[model samples]
Target: MFSGLSAFPLTPLNEKGIDEAVFVRLIERLNAAGVDSVCALGSTGSYAYLTRHERLRVAQLAVQHAGDVPVIAGIGALRTRDVLELAQDAQKAGAGGVLLAPVSYQKLSDDEVFGLFDAVTRSLSVPLCVYDNPATTHFEFSDELHGRIAQLPNVASIKIPGVPADPEAARARVDLLRALIPRHVTIGVSGDAFAATGLNAGCEAWYSVIAGLFPQIALAITRNAQAGNAREATGLSGRLAPLWALFLQYGSLRVIATAAELRGLVATPCLPLPVKSLQGEVRQRLAAILDELELA
Candidate 1:
């Protein structure tokens, strides 16, 4: 049950398999930045693009470089058995916990969803953190269902995306949903764009993509917000506003991949086939912002 800023490093891919040297260098840089925690093979990590062997290799590298800090292995798949096997692999690879999401082509009923979680909980040895990314999955869990799942043992936390930009509405939602979670269970915000508002609305920690390239700024904002420096946090958020806007306005996946490229964190920001790259104004805007921030 790790908290605070847990950065999901984007696993750079090339024509070959898992770019080992680049991946290792990225992990070492993130660890040296004093990150609270790191995750591999998540959505940002391009897990869907990797094979089973590649996922396992990346997970091993992440855990190896994580040192004492907790390593969260993102084990998400369309099949129950496959997800379970990956979870088992993560535990064997020295991961501290597993981040599971309901990944299925057919939209399942609440009963089916509950059943899937029940089986996963019973099968895994380590704690499980459920990821609620409705944008990608198109199935958002109701608070009632979350309340039921939170009661189970070995369930560590829930990752909720902070949709609906209005801070007031977002705050109300967080407060209500947080009540459904047991006192011991932690709540994290995954929407990097609205993370500041989410944190102000009672989120204990967050999962950020921006932290991959600019961990120092992300860490500064986290510390400021946690220490009750609202103005400072808001100011830092403004500094990051350009990048956030690009992710929201344009292609989020491209912007994220490009950030790694601009920072020289990865050899090439090559996304999976069918996922296009940014060009012209979009690429120029991202590059200019990164330059302004001196991320290069």
Candidate 2:
């Protein structure tokens, strides 16, 4: 469940609430693309914005539509109690795994973060993926902390941030983490721009934002890397440099939501409240880039 390409689909929203039909189609798209797993409520899915009931419903919908593909439901919340409840909800919804980040309004100490995972992992029947998205969670994980959390029961994977750009350094970073964690716990990489580098450097999985919308290309790169065709994998990622640039500049959530809207995959302004869709010249440029890359 932790290996290969894990696509993080957006939870498309409408005036009433979650656009259930659109969300189902997105899951079906991922399933059709043969992605290794579907992550229903990751950062790209706007998991943080959704209420507990909404998240549980999304998890259930994803599992229902995903068919054979394993569904990893995001179970992050500000309080550990809420996170635990979400985890139970995910398990009840038949999620294959749960992705958890130490979400905090107040900065969390290492012990507090460790406690969060320790508490959740104990009650979890399904495997748990440690979601270390420092960009969104605002809590960076030290390698030692990752090692500690990984030691707990049911910890299947650690979704680490992107590695260093340099080839040797990237490998070194991954290697260092590998040594810390147990052999059974897979190391997955986030950051769409660094997928190729991280995969080639020995990351077992790519927890991708772009894959949610453009699974074919993401799968090509992941398969190439997994097959040990480094050049092909790198080339495939290089072609998407324009898209990656936009992701870096505008944040992946906004860029991908905009792309989904442009492609007619979802309604205009599909994002949840307080998170507006892209507008004006940048939106136009995104369209141009999509066309130039033959991604539209």
Candidate 3:
């Protein structure tokens, strides 16, 4: 059903490369804090920067430390064949499922979208979660379209990131979409800040970057919200609000990397090439926010 909080941590890389000790430590912390699952090599993990080999290794590490928990490996790629290849590798590495967006070359037609799934679904032995981040893909999979995708046997979930400017609209969109999918197909909200609203809108679960940093608090919010305890959810979310705000303010993947660093879970806070590192006032603000949360 994909309920509760799931941590999606950054894939740390040192000069010597893939720091197993640090990676294992991060996964151990997430497990102890009650994270329902862990996602590896996603946007927060700088998947774009990693080679195929590194991605496989990260999946292996995640599976090794996940114990009984499910590990969803992000298998998104520009090429359809490559995406399926990674999905196959993910299953081989013992990942519970794969998360992927539509082909990134251009906005895909409905037919092309279906074809993308047609190719990738064949290789996915486990459940598949569709990623619908329009900001990244420049393609928004409408609720109607997602309903169609939900019919696929391997299609077990959907990931949507709402526009932060208009949360009400986001809730409405999520609600409309949630109503379309069958009960068995889990609807997963990806944006941390929108998770509570998504849950209230009947989303089955969520994928949270903040869960990677403060998994216990994320678990609290999800548990209370799921139980229909709005007051408890709000209070716990308030404690985690500062960290979410850092992601909004700092403006990039640094928030995830920095959060990992604050927890002493990752080897380096360095984001991959082309993405700027947090610095000066922005860095100080993040530090202050982490302090306010007592997570620094």
Candidate 4:
């Protein structure tokens, strides 16, 4: 379940609440694309903004509509108690695995982060993926800390941030983590732009944002890299350099939400409040890029 492309679809919202019908369509699209797994409530899914009830329903909808694709639900929360509750809810919602970022309002020490995973894993029957997304979590996981957490029961994968761009450095970074964690715990790389590099460097999975809306292109990169066609995979990723640049400038969530809107996969301003849709010239540029890349 943790060894290939995991698509993180956006949880579209309307004024009433979660746009369940649209969200289900997104999941079904991923299923038809044959993605290895569907990750609901991920950072791209705006998990942090949704209420517990909304998140539970999103997980249920994902699992229910994903058919045979394994559903990995995000169970992150600011409080451990709430995280525990959400983890249980996700399990009950039939998630095959859960992704957990160390969400916090205050800076967390390594021990506190470790304790969070320990507590959650103890109660979780489903496998847990350590979501090392420092960009949003505001807490970085030291290699040693990751090693410690990987030892816990049900720790199945570590979703590391992007690797070094240089090939040798990327491999060394992945190799160092591989040596630290148990062999069974796969290393999945986030940061969509780094997918090809990380996969070519030995990461077993790609937890992708772009894959949510454009699964076929993302799958081509994954398949090529896994088949030892490094040049082909890197070439494929390079073809979308303009899109990656946009991601760098505006953040992936906003950019992808904008793309979803342009593609008519979801309504305009599909993102939650405080996160307005991309506007003005940037949105136009995005559309042009998507057209040029044949993604639209």
**Local distance difference test values of all predictions, in order:** 0.80, 0.95, 0.76, 0.95
**Segments of candidate 2 deviating more than 4 angstroms:** none
Worst 10 residues of 2 by lDDT: 287-296
User: Which pairs of residues collide in model 4?
Assistant: none
lDDT digits (tens) for residues 1-296 of candidate 4? 99889999999996569888999999999999999999999999999999999999999999999999999999999999999999999999999999999998999999999999999999999999999998899998999999999999999999998999887899999999999999999999999999999999999999999999999999999999999999999999999999999999899999999999999999876988888779999999999999999995
Candidate 4 minimal-lDDT segment of 10 residues: 268-277
lDDT of 3 by residue, 31-61 (tens): 7787888988777776767778889999999
**Model 2 Cα lDDT, one tens digit per residue, 46-158:** 99999999999999999999999999999999999999899999999999999999998999999999999999999999999999988889999999999999999999999
Tens digit per residue, CA lDDT, model 1, 254-285 = 78887777666776646666665677777888
List ranges where model 3 is wrong by over 4 Å.
14-16, 163-171
Q: Check candidate 1 and list the clashing pairs.
A: none
* Superposed Cα deviation of residue 27, candidate 1 (Å): 1.0
The alpha-carbon RMSD values of the candidates against the true structure, listed in the order shown, are 1.5, 0.7, 2.3, 0.6
The residue pairs in collision within model 3 are none
Once fitted onto the true fold, the runs of candidate 1 whose alpha carbons sit more than 4 angstroms away are 163-166
Count clashes in each candidate, considering only residues at least 3 apart in sequence or on different chains: 0, 0, 0, 0
